[model samples]
Target: MAQLLAEKRDFDFVMWEQFNNEKFLENEKYEAFNKKTCDMILTEARKIAIKEMLPTMAEGDKVGLKFEDGVVTTPECFKPVFDLLKEGEWGNLGVPEVMGGQGAPSFVASAVSEYFMAGRSALSSYVSMGSGAAAMIQLYGTEEQKKKYVKRMVSAEWGGTMLLTEPNAGSDVGALETSAVKNPDGTYSITGNKIFITCGEHDLCSNIIHPVLARIEGAPAGTKGISIFIVPKYFVNDDGSLGDRNDIWCTGIEHKHGIVASATCSMAMGAKGTCIGYLLGNENEGMKIMFNMMNGARMHTGLQGLAYASGAYQLALNYARERVQMRELGQPHDAPPVTIIKHPDVRRNLLWMKSYVNGMRSFYQYMDYQEELSKIADTEEERALADGIFELLTPIIKSYLANRGYEVCVQAVQVFGGAGYTKDYLAEQYMRDCKIASIYEGTCGIQAMDLLGRKMGMQGGKVFMTFLAAIQNTIDEAKGLTELADLGERTQKMLNKLGEVAAHLGKNAMSPQYKTAFAHSLPYLDVMGDTIMAWMNLWRAVTATQKLAAKPKGKDLPFYEGQIKTAEFFIRTVVPTSMGRMDTILDMCSAAIDISDEAFGGL
Candidate 1:
């Protein structure tokens, strides 16, 4: 198989043709960047990803991390690439120039990130967390706080992490028991044990800055009284130099199934009564401050899914084209064996992988564009619309892509046959690595609850209505095109049914059967995801159809034709199943919740 991370042609088509990202150049914030500059940036990023970072992916997974005493050592291959990321300032591309970053547009940064993630998500995690931490500090920290931490974290000179989960608290973050006591020096003495802290303790950087969530001595209980503090592994002096070691220590690291290079450390703080921390934002606002990092982490988790699926698909495609199998279905018995791509079932699996990958890439790029739009919109209403839609779709993007991206990886494995299951092939590793996306940074079930519980009703349901309306507008556009008119009508039916299903779920959620409604929230999210995928595929078909009408030649012809066919495959095949799910959801069955605890059988 080729060492391809993702298809460049598809990337170009999504950004320039589908999104028309050139329009962003007209905005003053993006005026310094033009099409050529953005393309060159992607080119350089791709080079770094493919040549410098890709080699570490397999080594990291195989060799994994080594934890000894109080230190965690990452794979040796990661250090050189980590250095490249810092020296090249690659981690700060999305940060604004005013905040001491490259000031690239969000979509451009997203595209750049996709490449690096495809190369090695474990290594990329180190960069992304540092950037995310710096972003939070830049947003909510005091000027002095920013001065001490932001620049170093942004440049990847120091590492960063968010320590939230304890042995008692995972999804129920409000139930955390970490405590903080105010001290005479205007700092807080913190004590806590945090688990699953990514990049919590790594040798890639000299220092690790932790934004820990803990409750003050006299604060109220639960999430409301929580506070965020800047707890570093080594203290920073006023002169921007290193001070004595802080009390935070990594006692051990988890031996995980995948992404093994990342140090998921079990951290202990104030073991010797010397964990000093400066409060971030204000007391009792930790949830609010920590969410700034959490939300970004969710988005990053979604991208991890997309990257794994993309890399797997590319490998499967290459394998299918080269791996010869049995004779073609309709060929003579004496005929020579054909490549696996010639087989019908293999074709179906490839198409399934293709359509989802295409849809996912487009969906992520759409969100990336919306992030930029929210920032640069001319009016408050415009900004709110962009931001609101992005907000409403966050869980969908995070959960749906995660669940489906894993499915796509499964299909890739199927395409590779027996070889896919072995360590010799990356497909197996991709499967293992992508599984965590659905489980961590908010499980898929938690994301579904967030969607049904809070996001759908935002601003009196206006935001969700707006989201559906945007899909309708695409359906309407597709209806205008002769080639896509049939798919358009079919997709429109799904959209209408989704609205009805939403209403039914909403009614059930508020009434006596609210538990039943919550029981089916995952299914509701699935249907929503399917409908959205159909919408993305249909939109891509419409664009490709229009481009084909212009009579393009060479490779463009097959690519455009493939787009239309992929849409047909999903709409004709997948949407009907989603419709069935919607029907099931409408019934609001209470069986799952009504079952008696004693009736269940266990070992």
Candidate 2:
């Protein structure tokens, strides 16, 4: 089971060496965390994850969730683990101390999260969704609202979720029909039904607070009139004690293909005309507030990709090392069959998995570092740079990592062959659970549109240009090193071509042929994702080259060398395909849009 989680040495390399954890500790915002303390935190989290949580992963998936009337019963094994997480306060690791959380740095919290999430994503969502809600309340809630909800939410005493999707408004929030009417007091009465609400009605917490999106009576139409309200499962009194039950009820839970332990609910609010809710930010600003939380929520969604993919790759690697079935290509026919790891094809697959897993981990940590910098930077300029880059990378990290991460999981299944498809192994589960990452938190299509439509045009393209420039810096530094010169040159060429592609896409998106540009937006995002992966691999190579100069001995030698080799494998093996993909994009073929629907034979 331990072998199924992230490689600790690689995790340390990204945290301590690649991104430099020490620099984050220099900021007073993170003064409470030193390397030792962070290590202890990670160690404790790993223990809880491996020993207490990992055992429940398959058990939870098999047992799934139970719905009796309006109540949801999670997997029997999840209760103890959930209790342990809440008791240890692991859920609030990244929240600030002032806000009743442990105040760990973003990087450390992310490492801790990788362990827990890899152990069991469904169980972790309970806390994560609540923390997300608490963060919103902390940022936008009135003092009374914060006083009523934040601390309890931080402790997971009460659960939290965002209720936006209705039967009519899956992706389009403006079309939602949930309504709110002003009450005698400042509170409003909420009436609506919501679908796909995660952790919406679980038995884990005493109460569930919902940040529901509803338009007030007499408000204007469309999203401009939408307002957000804090509606709890059970009302809270003036003293913060649980009060009468609210009008919200869980109608049903979805039987999903994966993450079965999580209760994706059909929630009906104000059936009795008594659902009392307090306004969150202000009237007619719900979408704006929700968009603010979307980045974090989307990043959280992105983590699912890394979690499932890492665990799947680890499982595949372990299986290869143990499963003996193949002989080397040149070995005698009568010779002993070696472990699958000795097979060249299997080795290539493992390296393919290794390279992506390694790159994804580094890229995730890099994004976390940007978040830390944005918060801790002294100068406004530094903060802006961090903010700009973080925003620009958001869609890429969310969409690319998710889509690639799913592919990695699929590849892991392929590596395991027939055994992978059975319930006996967790590879299939990883693939199943990971499929949702690309579909949820807005689909990959939505992410592609956001990247091309909004993010590309941010600050008149300065943010996008800055991101490319940052990647170029790594390429330039790697070019100076003899060991990495060729790898860096190839990556630099890809980066240059990517810039041109971006320019072409940007122009087409604004031109009369916008439909053609939108048709290929997803492919454009794919190449961008590939380019970012290459950049991450090159960065790892530079770090490994610098470390090799120190003459590390024993296991460290292979580990450092592996980083360079992984970079070479990706740049040499995979990036040429990305270059070809870029060519197809430049061709700007309109077959997708030009084809008439009636011309298809399927009908």
Candidate 3:
């Protein structure tokens, strides 16, 4: 409601300074895009979001989807918003030009995603899911498959969905019971029910293409037998025109906690014995192909977390500045009532919210730049390093941002006081919408296990060592500034402790003692994420310090001062809190695994 997109400074800073768009513009593929063009795209996207999407967001939440007679119907207000997005071609921003797309760089697209996501989380889900599905098709589809689907999908003429989750298989995708039988004509017949499928069924587009994972008859068990397929709601003809409706229908929709505008449908495939699907890649290699999309989706989900946090903060900030309340200490009782923003505690919460959102934006953008580089790096070794770093940071970006972003949203509600708890305000909705981010895209616990168990040990630990070296470089650079120098000392000590933890986990991973060490894995992830963020923010402050020293005194001065102050606040407040968390982790005092299931049966 407070227009979070207009107040976004962190994204601009990352794009212009940290990510360095000039480097991308020089590429032959991105030669048409410059600063002016990027600005125009962002401006247009914001206009569409405010005019078309934001207005429907509240209405969608108020009048959620209704299920009747085996069909799911969305809020009536969602139609116009979906139409505007389709007309604007915003869904095709990063798609290749050969497929009738704008072919923008990933960094630019990431920025656009943040703006849209901040405006309305539910509407953005439709676009992101479609784009993610299109990316998968573009990457692995055969030439004929690409010609049949890519153009329409890129233009948003066709919507897309990923059908991986089932009632029995959520995070353990390998446990899926969906079956695919090869027909004589080469197309496979798919049969299964998929639950919690977002954008699975909607009248917003002419067709819906689903990337489904199923197992072939008599195939090897577990993940080894899994295969990816493209199943459309309607079969496409050789001439690329719609042909016949396939045997896929929405059986019902979930009564979700939030994101009510996007339909989370329960789908039945091959109930009538005619669901046709085409394999995307080689048999038994489906998991490998799907990871391409899952990894991207995980990152985009992190962006959604940041978006909700920023939106909540923006609303709270506006309320704080406008709503009058009781007087602070040292003020005259007769003095006019002042806004809550005048109070130090409220200001502290708002600053914490701001710093966390800003740090996440910068960190996420850096990861996007790494992904783009992985695609275009000239040398194999450089590409390999980029790939490894991207892999290592993905779990952190997803787990840390989702966990902290939700906390920041809670703080934002606190800033709003009583009004925040009521449905009359949007803060409560933001909290509900953001809560799922941690549970989906693999839970925070799963991400921690991935980080500690696999990523840190990949390629004989070279990637972890590289990341440590980067953190060390930040420390070395910060040594010249006294305030940051002290902060760097503490961060380095935490980094040392993390290294020790990694070593201990590596040595005893096979024994039953590993479970004891595993209990602290999540805390290790939190400490690692905070350490990385502090390192990045300090680097930014160092840059701001240099710029401030050379600038003329004016309005520009406050911007630099804000940057410096935020860095100091984060180091003093946040870093020390992370130290305490690390101590608890080292203490290994939690009873999480030791307790019996019956102890919690009261629920």
TM-score, each model?
A: 0.99, 0.99, 0.95
- The C-alpha stretches of model 2 lying farther than 4 A from their native spots are none
Model 2 TM-score, 2 decimals: 0.99
Stretches of candidate 3 exceeding 4 Å from the true structure: 1-3, 552-555, 589-591, 595-603
Instruction: Mark the 10 consecutive residues where model 2 has the least summed lDDT.
Output: 1-10
Residue 77 lDDT (model 3): 83
| C-alpha root-mean-square deviation, candidate 1 | 1.1
Per-residue lDDT tens digits for candidate 3, residues 172-231, read 999999999999999999999999888898767788999999999988988899999999
Order of candidates by lDDT, top first?
1, 2, 3
For model 2, what is the C-alpha lDDT against the true structure? 0.90
**Across residues 1-603, which tens digit of lDDT does each residue of candidate 2 receive?**
337588778878999998887987987777788999988888888888889988899999999988998999988898888898999899999988867998998888888888888899889999788888898899999998999999999889899999999999987889999999998888999988999999999999999999999999989988999999999999898999899898999999999999889889999988866888899998999998887778888888888899889999999999988888957789999888988989889999999988889888899999998998898888998899899889888988888889889999999998888999998898999899999999888999989998899989888998898889999999999999998999999998999999999999999999998999999899999999898899999999999999999999998999999999999999999999999999998999998888999886689
For each candidate, the alpha-carbon lDDT, in order, equals 0.90, 0.90, 0.82
Candidate 3 collision pairs? none
Backbone steric clashes in candidate 3, count:
0
Scored by Cα lDDT, where does model 1 land? Answer: 0.90
Residue 370 local lDDT, model 3: 80
Model 2 pairs whose backbones collide? none
